[model samples]
Target: METQARLIVDVARLDEDGERYQGELSLALLDLGASEVFAPKGALAYDLFAQALGTELLVRGTLSLPLNCICVRCGGEFQKVVQDRDFVTSIEISEATDFLDLTDEVREAIILDLPSYPVCSDTCKGLCMTCGKNLNKEICACQKAGSDRRWATLEGL
Candidate 1:
């Protein structure tokens, strides 16, 4: 089934004690073009939970995203799966507003959780400084240069 990204909670249906709703949603991260940290391979799977609390709505969920990332050191493409379980946010509803849209909130949460520096692997050798060749795949023939002259004065001490 096609899942809508927006979660509109009806305030009128909620009781004095509040009501809880749960469902699974498929978010089109790719279509949205949300961020550059990680590119979405397809629809992200998310388990959503919401509770209407008077004028406020408490939203919580867990999501797993299949992402394509570029290594910061070597600039190589790699795949990564980002899973967030403790995702939570809240929305306020007024007398005029009947429903609250949680789509933007969800998208923001995903973007904020992305890694600043993505690595292909822990043992990634990165690129050769002199030849600009990927060190992880092959060793470059470029000779290793000596230490910088600015740092040479400190090396004696």
Candidate 2:
């Protein structure tokens, strides 16, 4: 199915009282076109659970994405699988339009859940301030100096 068609629900097929529809959606359906948080390699999987309530559609589900992120401190590359299980949103459909597309909603949910500052690990030592070397991988000579010239004047106080 076409990307847009895959994310659309035919409201005419659902009962007015409320009916549940379950399905799996590919990441391509929720593609944001371009994003910093989404990786280009791994496939994202979305487990969808939607309910029809009269003219409204209630969507709730989980989505998993393998993300390629950069360490905020060390500037190193790393991969992490992120999941959003609390995804929930609602859309209104009119009698004239029997379809509701969830592409934008799903895309927003994934983006909102991304970490503001991503790190490779909890103990990442970051970089040596003086020589700008990754401290996590090796010790630097500047570290032994143990004193910063910027703070030299403070010693007198």
Index of the highest-lDDT prediction:
2
lDDT of each: 0.70, 0.72
Model 2: per-residue Cα lDDT over 1-157, one tens digit each: 5543356667777665554544445557666453553353455567777777666678787876777888888989898877898888888766776778776776777777777688899999999989999999988878756656546757867
Q: Which stretches of candidate 2 lie over 4 Å from their true place?
A: 1-5, 15-40, 94-97, 147-157
Candidate 1 deviant stretches above 4 angstroms: 1-5, 10-31, 34-38, 94-98, 142-157
Any residue pairs clashing in model 2, and if so which?
A: none
- Taking all chains together, each candidate's TM-score versus the true structure is 0.66, 0.70
RMSD (Cα, Å) of candidate 2?
A: 4.4
Which window of ten consecutive residues has the lowest lDDT sum in model 2? 32-41
Model 2 TM-score, 2 decimals? 0.70
Question: What is the overall TM-score of model 1 with all chains considered together?
Answer: 0.66
